[model samples]
Target chain A: MSAREEVLARLRAARDVGGSTVPDVPRDYHRTGVHAPGSAAAVERLTETLTDYRATVHRVGDLDGVPAAIAAVLAGSSSVVAPPGLPGEWLGEVTATVRRDDPPLSVADLDRLDAVVTGAAVAIADTGTFVLDALAPDQGRRAISLVPDHHVCVIRAADVVSSVPEALARLAPDGPLTFVSGPSATSDIELDRVEGVHGPRRLDVVLIVPPRA
Target chain B: MTTDLGMPTVASDPHGHLRGTEPFPVAAHRALADTQLRQNLGHATRTIRAKRAAVVGEVDDWEELRRAGECVKADVMARLPELLEQLEASVTARGGVVHWARDAEEANRIVVGLVRETGSDEVVKVKSMATQETGLNEALGAAGIAALETDLAELIVQLSDDKPSHFLVPAIHRNRSEIRDIFLREMPDVDPDLTDEPRRLAMAARAHLRRKFLSARVGISGVNFAVADTGTISVVESEGNGRMCLTLPDTLITVMGVEKVVPTWSDLEVFLQLLPRSSTGERMNPYTSSWSGVTPGDGPQTFHLVLLDNGRSNVLASPDGRQALHCIRCSACLNVCPVYERTGGHAYGSIYPGPIGAVLSPQLTGIDGPDDVNASLPYASSLCGACFDACPVRIDIPHLLVQQRAAAVEAHGRPTAQDLAMRAAAAAMASPGRFSLTERVVKLGRLLSRSGRIRSVPGPGAAAWFGARDMPEPPAETFREWWGRRERS
Candidate 1:
């Protein structure tokens, strides 16, 4: 028998001899956030949690507020990488020269850029995590955000969910996804968390909230 | 009907020198004397423990989540063969190749062959315990490939020519100054004025690794969770080195134990919540990169998943002991273990250490008939029950430790003095007559008492027990005698 067959055989024999019992999974845990889905409380909790993780949170009233928030976050940058299909108005007020990644920028090209701005697929309020599916129009290939030094992710209030399960429900499982919680950080050195290691050192989350009635 | 694959399905002892030659006690004794190691472990474990407790306390359904996680793993184990077949088909359909290895040697050979085919003399690596378990780096080096460890802690361990002492922080044993010295002495282009500050140290490593990440052709990693339904594999990490290696390389090879698979993408919902809070005490790790087999013009276009069984089947064979496979490699058990906090990771000898390692290593090596060091691992713990409490999956590590101890004792052909004493005590307690006779004999031991305590005794094991504690003097009357007098009255 090949190694595969032998291994499988052994597993089968073990299962037969031991007769392992599978238990029913109790999933009584909170699958949804305690706060109502897409409620103001959820967005507020997300903002606070993201801030706690050291990601600068900028609460914008709407899409119109996004450009100014982007500009403020990228105030010192000379050049920025914007993914293809990103709303043109989002970068309208920024003085930094916008570099479109329609053809996709090289690693060196991205490394030299000062910042990256993209939209998120969905955001989890409880865990303060944001998912970036490469197939999404605003969230380009994984490299665009990874190679740059700073990232400014735009999260609409509607896209913010209460928990990880809610966030997973919104994502397409087949696409490559990166769930980012904070700026690249490491507790590897003496188990002391020192933010900014290999990925973007600075993360600015622009929360686009809808106008209240 | 039987066909030989020219490889031993049941390896006599494939771990070799990796399972350190000395038993745990001797090694732990040497480790105990290192006050520096003890202090480093104490400080790190305490800090992580506090953070984990705070975050875990915030989750109201933490227990429910743990139970669900355990069930998912148990289901996976019960139907492992079918699930693996499903995983193989899904991955193959999505442009990934799957290879199976029965033991460590075959796993190493398969990995080395893949690197040779890539024709890359050097490979960048994420911090992977699977690779460490297989000793893949040593195998790759022998085949003329330099496997550069890219994770910050792994880099420290690699550069200093030391083994990883902790799971999350491999260099947890090294202080800031020691890390600085290692970087300065080993890193080729390090700054001359590098201080011992952690931020400066991180910056120096980032600069050093950037060049390698940009140019690497092949990257190697371990799987945190493999989604059998979607053919996706996820790696949870803090630093961006994992992202760099997983994305920049043209070819990627991942070595995953069969136990790492979960049934569906939705199952990740439970683990994603459990792992981060349990391991690093983060709401979520800094980065969790998940990719299905291969994506065009994005992450590695060529992907290979190596399914490793190196004694996992043996572990699955026992009904009472098989829950050991439920571990998520969170190292929560290690952080809370009283023994591990004192002796550190080296004393366990395997790349795996602490409470989980004590039960895991011996079974993974098949301790049924051996008097080797692996058998000694079953006795490495104090059975304090901290590891089980801290385990996110609730593996019941102390129960497994006791079970493995019984198996080890049964395997020993000759009974030791302690075993003889235990047998005699069991026999004496079997009946009221025997018990009363033994109690009468025990009253004679009052003669050896000095000032109401017996500090020493003549038995081989009694000396060691008496060294730290004193035995109390026997009571004047047996409990049975008192019960009979009361009944008469």
Candidate 2:
């Protein structure tokens, strides 16, 4: 018999001998946030959680506020890599030279850049996490957000969800996704958390909140 | 007893089973004397334990989540064969190729063959327990391929020529100064003024791994969770080394145990929540990258998934033992285990250590022989239930420990002095006549007592116990005799 056959047979025999039955899963955990979805409280909680993880959270009123927020966050950046299909006006007020990655930048090129400005597909408020799908225009490929030293992500208030289950519901399961909670960190040494290792050291989340009517 | 396809003994393949040369007690004794190791372990485990407790306490439905996680894993085990077939189909439908390995030798051969096909002599690696279990690095080295461990802790263990002592932090046994010395000696272009500060150590490792990540053609990793429905594989880590290895390489080979698979993508929500909080005490880790087979113009274009069944089926054979497969490799059990916190991971001898390892390694290797280190592992624990409480899936490790002990004793065939004592005690307790006679004879213990306690025991098997502890002297009168006197009055 082939190795595959042997393994399958062994598994079958084990299952038969064990005679175990699968039990129904109980999911009584909170699926929604304490604050209503897309509410002001939800945004505030996300900001607090993100800040706790050491990601600078910038609250902007709307799309018009994005350019100023981007400029303020990238004040010291000399050059920034912007993904293809990113709103050009988001970087309008920034003095840093904008490098468009329509053809995608090399890893070395990305490494040299000051920061990468992109948009997130969805954000989780409770855990303070953001998902980036490569197929999404503003998110670009996984390399842009990772290779640069700093990352300034633009997240709309509407995209923020309450919990992990709600966040998973919005993502494409088969697409390449990177769920980043904060700047790269490690607790490997002495169990002490030291931020910044291999990935972007600085993360700035720009919250694009809609102004109250 | 054997039929059709005669199973090859696990001993035939040297790397298939991992067991220490010395018994656990002998190894633990040496470990106990190492005050430095004890201090390091005490500090790390306490810090991690407190952090995990704080985060886990925040969740109101933590118990429910744990139960759900257990059920999901149990379902996977019950339907493992079908799920594996579905996973193979899903992965193959995408651009990935799936290979099956019955043991470590075949797994190593398949991985080496793939690397040879890529024409690459070096492979960058993410921190993978599966690779460690298979001793993949050693196998690759024997085949003339360099497998560079990219994770910081793993790099420390690799550079120092030491085995990993912890699951999350492989070099948890080493202090900061020790790491500094290892880097200065092993790292080629390390800074001369490197200090014992953790940030400096992390920076030195990052700089050392950068060159390899940028130029490597092939990368090797292990799967944290393989979604059978979407053919997607996820790697969760606090550092970005996993992302670098998973993305930059042209060819990627992942070795995953068959039990790592979940039924669907939605099932990840529970694990993604349970793992980080339980393992590193993070709401979510710094980075969690998931991808289906291969993506064009993006991550690795060539992907191979090696499904490993290295004694996992053997573990699944027993009803009580099958819960060992429910482990998520979180190391929560290790952090809370009293035995592990004292002896550390090395005393267990396998790459896997702690309470989970005590049950897992022995079952995986089978405790059928007298001299097997696995047989000794069943006795490594104090039967404390801390590991079960810390376990995200609630594996009932104490119950498994007792069960494995019984199996180990049976495998030994010859009864030791302790076993004889237990048997005699059982026989004496079986009959009322024997019990009363034994109770009447128990007054003789007063003759051996000094002051109010017996300082030493006479038996060879119990000398060690009594050497450190004192037993109280027997009462002047038996309970039955006292009751009779009361009745007479």
Candidate 3:
């Protein structure tokens, strides 16, 4: 028999011999947080967690405040690239030559740029994490967010959720997704956490709060 | 009703890392004798333990979450065959090919062939326990392809030609100074002025592997969780190397144990919370990358998923011992195990070294007899119940350990002297007359007691058993005798 057939047959036998007792997994664990998504408390928790993870956080009052926040985060970066679908107005104040991924940038193009700016699909306040879906035009492809040393991710105040399950519920498993909590870090050496290895060493999370939905 | 369910599925991959090299006692004795290793193990485990406690303590519903995680894995085991079928179809529907391997050799062959098809002479690797278990790098090396390990700890072990010593930190046996020496001697372009500082050492590694990650055509990795419902496979990692390999390579090959497949996408909710807090003592890992299959103008358009059995079927056959299959490779059990902390991971002699490895390795490759190296694993644990308590999935590791011990005794082929003694004791205890007579005869041992303790006894394993501890002297009078005297008074 082929490997697939043999393995399946063995699993079936074990099921038959062991008795069929499908377990009922309880979902009593907190699926949503006490603080509502995008609430003041939720935003406060997000800032605390992101700061603890060593990501620089800047909060702006509204859509108009996003340009200055993005500009300040990318101050050290000479060249910045934004997804084609990313609003042109978000980078209006960015002094760095803001390039658009119109034709879709290559690895070489992403390598030369100092930083990349994009919008997040959602952000979790409890874990200080954000999700980037390739299908989200604002999020662009996975590589664009990965290659550059500095990643300036713009999260709207309303996107923040309280817990992991709450954040996961808003996501679809249909395409490539990246869940980033902090800048690259490792605990390999003597089990001590040292940040800045491999991925973007400098992660500037810009939380835009105003223009309330 | 069933004629053939595949009886001898217990044999593991010949090239796999399941079997230990030597007996546990002997290897552990050698490891304990090394003071430097004991210090290394103590510091690393203790550091991780404290961090884990702090993170896990903060969660208000931690126990509830662990329970849900445990039950979810149990559900996956009950629905194993169906989940795997769904996963294969989903991955295929999304333009990814799937291959199945029964053992280690087959897995190695299939992966090598896939890499050869890509026609790349080299591949960059993310740190994966499955690859370590299958010894993939050696197979690739023999086939004239280089598989460079990108994780800092894995790279150190690779450069030194040493086996991994821990699940989370493979080079825990080496301090920063030793790491510096290894890098200076082995790495080709390392700076001469390198110090033992971890930040500097990590920067050095960054410079070394950057060219490889950017230029490599093939990337090899292991799956953390594969969502059968969506054909999505996720890799959770801390360092950016995982992202570099998963992102930069043109073709990607993922080797996943069949037990890793979960039925639905939502199942991730329980495990994601359970893993990081338990494994690395962090609220979240630095990055978690998941992709369904191929995407145009994106990372790794060509993808292949290899489903590995390698004696997992053998583990699944046992009624009670099968819970070993629920492990998520978090290594929390290892950090809390007293035996592991003292003897260090090297003593276990398997890629999986710790309380989990002790129960898991034996079940993966059935204990043939006393001489079967994996047989000693069932006895490696002190059965303090720490492992089960620390397990994120609540595997009941101590219960499983006893079950494996019973299985080992049954599979011994011939009874040992200890087995005969146990049977005799059981028989004596079953009958009232035999029990009374045995109790009466056992009190005669007071004649040999010096200070109400039996320092030595003569039997098959008595000397070894008495080496570490002394037996208390039997009471002079039986309980029934004392009861009769009291009644007469």
- Point to the candidate with the largest DockQ: 3
All candidates in order of lDDT, best leading? 2, 1, 3
* Cα RMSDs, all models: 2.3, 2.0, 2.3
Question: Candidate 3 residues A67-179, lDDT tens each?
Answer: 88898888788999888789999999989998788788778888899999989998888788999998888988888898889999999888999899988899998889899
Question: Per-prediction TM-score, chain A only?
Answer: 0.96, 0.95, 0.96
DockQ of each: 0.65, 0.69, 0.71
lDDT tens digits by residue: candidate 1, A1-213:
777888788887776665656667778878877887678999999998899989999998978888899999899999999989799999999999999998988888888899999999999999888999998889989999899999999999989898998888788767789999989999987777899899999999999988778
Instruction: Identify the superior model by DockQ, candidate 2 or candidate 3.
Output: 3
TM-score on alpha carbons, each prediction:
0.96, 0.97, 0.96
Alpha-carbon shift of residue B254 in model 2 (angstroms) = 0.5
lDDT by residue (A1-213, candidate 2, tens digit) is 787888788788887777668777777766666777677888888998899899999988889899999999999999999989799999999999899997978888887899999999899888889999988888888888888889999999999987888889889867689999999998988887888889888999999888777
C-alpha-based local distance difference test score of model 3: 0.87
Report the lDDT tens digits of candidate 1 across residue range B111-138: 9999999989999999998888888888
Q: Name the docking class for model 3.
A: medium
In candidate 2, residue B54 scores what lDDT?
A: 88
Q: Pick by TM-score: which candidate is best?
A: 2
